[model samples]
Target: MRSLVLCLLTVVAFGSCLKLPSSFKKCDRKRTDFNQCLSDAIYGALKILDKPLPSHGLPSLYDIEFPDEVATIGNRTYGLLQTYYRPRCIGLSKPENINAKLEFGPLTSTLTIEATYSQLTVETGFEAQGTIVLLPVNVVTPFEYTLVNPTYTFTFELEEYEKGTTYFRVIDSKLDMQAHGLKLDYKQLFSNKILNDEFNSAMNVKWREIFALSKSIDEDVFAPLFGTIVNGFLKRVPVADLFDG
Candidate 1:
């Protein structure tokens, strides 16, 4: 009886000492990478928006109101905005991206935008990919505007898996006013510009805060399930210093 009890205890100890599978370990690593990538991506977008750009001519349109309904998740309340801008030159385009702004009262909190693309194939299967970009569009009051409006364009290929989708979806899109016959009042342009600037600034600050919080949550929640994917992908590719000062 004594020998049997000792044997059972030894077996239990050995079982406890068994190592986790290599794939599981890889997964954990990848998850960490994924969380890091998410953080970097969010922070990177914010950095781009935060960089001081010459405030040229007052925005073509003004006072674009955001949704007032606040969403509370844990200790945070989120506000959202939807806008669409039609490119002067267009070939083919999808709807606007969903731009999310989070707030805690007068202080602006966070800004995030999400867009999705889909590709359908009979042999491979339907694939959908979504990208969420977080940026700080801080609005400063008394914002001076120049008469010159600079045109900007950005293009990047969607991730490999996402490229296969047949349909593309853009959530929370922003529309350019010139196309819609919307004009800004020259007299109220300053005040409107200031308000808009201030709003964007507040949103930018909020974005940074929420992004940090989200990364923490993502790390905790998805680490086990998707860490390996993140790690593997990052390891194979050269990491870029996107947000480096």
Candidate 2:
């Protein structure tokens, strides 16, 4: 979920270079409709990123493969211990109602973006050995999670980096997300069929509780990962060239 969302931000932050594909539209800072233009440009850019653009340092968003991610539900005192290995995510809906704002300052700048995505689906191998809701269970099974109508807000703080030419690098970043619905499916909870079915049923019924419990993962895992990847590409092109004067 983190990598998928930030990939869009990477495209939005990329500067205007000569090698860019014609699909990307640049907005002028002096224009009154700059925000609307920025939103339109970002929507168009994401649509054409179905294939990797090596010249632009962009990867295919058709399927985003992520490294093993480990996260715990609660502290050692108490909570469920959950882990996900080799998660593959797809079905990233095109962003809608996109709004992008860039506040240029003398020393630094801030970029705040708000967008809504229709859906995102994730499938991963899961392991849960610890206690969940006072249930003693150890399970290793394939997990599928889906988010419906998720809206995300991202704010990036940028500073100038000089590499012969002045470029922008993300110094800090924050991400906030809310979803209308969530679907969770993992069949094998225990060796017993009855227990397995009941557990899976409970999870599907109570996914909102799970989401609230794991909400911190956004800040803990997503934000830093997003900042690093955005900065990696954002620093390549001169800041002055990203927008029209």
Give the worst 10-residue stretch by lDDT in candidate 1.
119-128
- In candidate 1, what are the lDDT values of residues 75-163, reduced to their tens digit? 11132231111111111122122232221123221222232212100011111122113332222112111111211111111222121
> Per-residue lDDT of 35-85 in model 2, one digit per residue for the tens?
888778776776776666666555555566667565555442366667777
Q: Which stretches of candidate 2 lie over 4 Å from their true place?
A: 1-19, 74-80, 131-136, 191-194
Models 1 onward score TM values of: 0.16, 0.81
Candidate 1 regions exceeding 4 Å error are 1-197, 206-208, 228-245
Residue 99, model 1, lDDT: 30
What's the residue-level lDDT of 72 in candidate 1?
19
Error of 2 at 237 (Å): 2.3
Give the best candidate by TM-score: 2
